[model samples]
Target: MVTDTRLYRKVTAQAWDRLDSRPARRTAWLGYDGSLPVIAGTVICLVVQKLPGGGGNKPVEAS
Candidate 1:
């Protein structure tokens, strides 16, 4: 469980790192596929996007 959580966080953080190095645009999408903590081997999806005129305030969605 702990390993899964760490891996999930690592994947998410890597996505954010890549996004941060890019130039700002009208829109952008970032997604992560990883395991969940409580559900053991079960996986989940996390998506985030930069909204129009958000000026860097991106919104995140997790499933």
Candidate 2:
């Protein structure tokens, strides 16, 4: 979980390089400007939905 760890940095750097080198020109419009936020929000929502009592899969009943 420690981002400062060498392994984490290396893996992330490699992934970034691979993604960065893509020939897709849309990256300029999509990277941080659009897709990143949407992707991040999706990830947050999925994480919250998975947490216990986060009301993900079960329905709550009124008393």
Candidate 3:
């Protein structure tokens, strides 16, 4: 059995070269701003939580 050392080294080098080549993505919190959309969502959730039934308002059906 003949082992190709040159090919093995080339493949190893290629793999290492791609280790940090991915485009870095900024985290959600880091890229997000204090905008109206965020504020609106928060307010909506708060309002929902403040509802009479504490959230779900489905009427119970009598059997």
Which has the greatest lDDT? 1
Worst ten-residue run, lDDT, model 2?
40-49
lDDT of 2: 0.29
lDDT of 1 by residue, 1-63 (tens): 122342223223222321223224323333423432232232334432432344544445553
Model 2 quality (TM-score):
0.15
Candidate 2 C-alpha lDDT tens digits along 1-63: 112433222111111111222234565565445433222111111112143344434433421
The root-mean-square deviation over C-alpha atoms between each candidate and the true structure, in angstroms, is: 17.9, 14.9, 26.0
- 26: Cα error in model 2, Å: 61
Instruction: Give the per-residue lDDT digits (tens) of candidate 3, residues 1-63.
Output: 222343232111111121222224435447655542311111111111123334553433321
Q: All models: lDDT?
A: 0.33, 0.29, 0.28
Candidate 1 stretches greater than 4 Å from native: 1-37, 40-54
Clashing pairs in 2: none
Error of 3 at 16 (Å): 77
Q: Which candidate, 1 or 3, would have the higher TM-score against the true structure? A: 1
